[model samples]
Target: MALFDDLFIRLTSRKVGRDRFGNTYWEARSRKDAYGRPLRRVTYAGVPEASAVPPEWWGWLHHTTDRPLPEDAPRRPWQKEHRPNMTGTREAWRPPGHDAAGGRRQPSPGDYEAWTPGR
Candidate 1:
């Protein structure tokens, strides 16, 4: 066992719950800090990767939802599951008129205006 694990087991209270990614949470039962003042603490175990948490879990962790997402959250026949943003990737945004295969067509004549220095 790791030194931290050994120390954590000896010092903290009981294990609360674990997420699907193997991250565990431990909540202090006795409300007391090192100085004996009433305090609550939550300890996280495993690699602390924020992205590992799903959107529903994120909402619950931030107290946005009182209940953890249902084990079998409803999915409509037409609804699609959530996907991470990919705006900056190679497969990202391509406007309808932009070139994807080869040279793009020039802008139409009505799309331009003659600029005057004074105006």
Candidate 2:
């Protein structure tokens, strides 16, 4: 959707943070709205894809956390970086035997046997 948002306004708004993908986060500098509630917003890097937002920033955007992830926090080996959803796109993954791969899984030898008559 097209919005008539003024570039000057965005330029002057409080610069919250920038994610790895270049997405810019913002919060009202005034800290509170007319109703005395906190204001937060995120300007996506591109195309405004929901999945494009990383988990850490997402938590802050959604008010799940009072602050974004600490920059100095050590990352665990088991933790993985976030990636946008790729479902239905060419980048999406398909298993080896999937119909899109033009192949079918072959049954392993001795995996099964037909029962004729008991010997």
Residues 1-119, candidate 2, lDDT per residue (tens digit)? 13544353375467779888888888776667666756777777678888988877889987789888874578899977777789998889988778887778766588687878975
Task: Pick the lDDT winner.
Answer: 2
Model 1 scores what on Cα lDDT?
0.54
The 0-to-1 C-alpha lDDT of every candidate, in the order given, reads 0.54, 0.76
Please give, for residues 1-119, the per-residue lDDT of candidate 1 as tens digits.
46785476547655545555555544455756576643322233444445555554565555566445653577779865544455666776677566662546657789688899999
Score every model by TM-score. Answer: 0.43, 0.64
Q: What are the runs in model 1 whose C-alpha is more than 4 Å off?
A: 1-52, 98-119
Scored against the true structure, residue 72 in model 1 reaches a CA lDDT of 58
lDDT of 1 at 62: 55
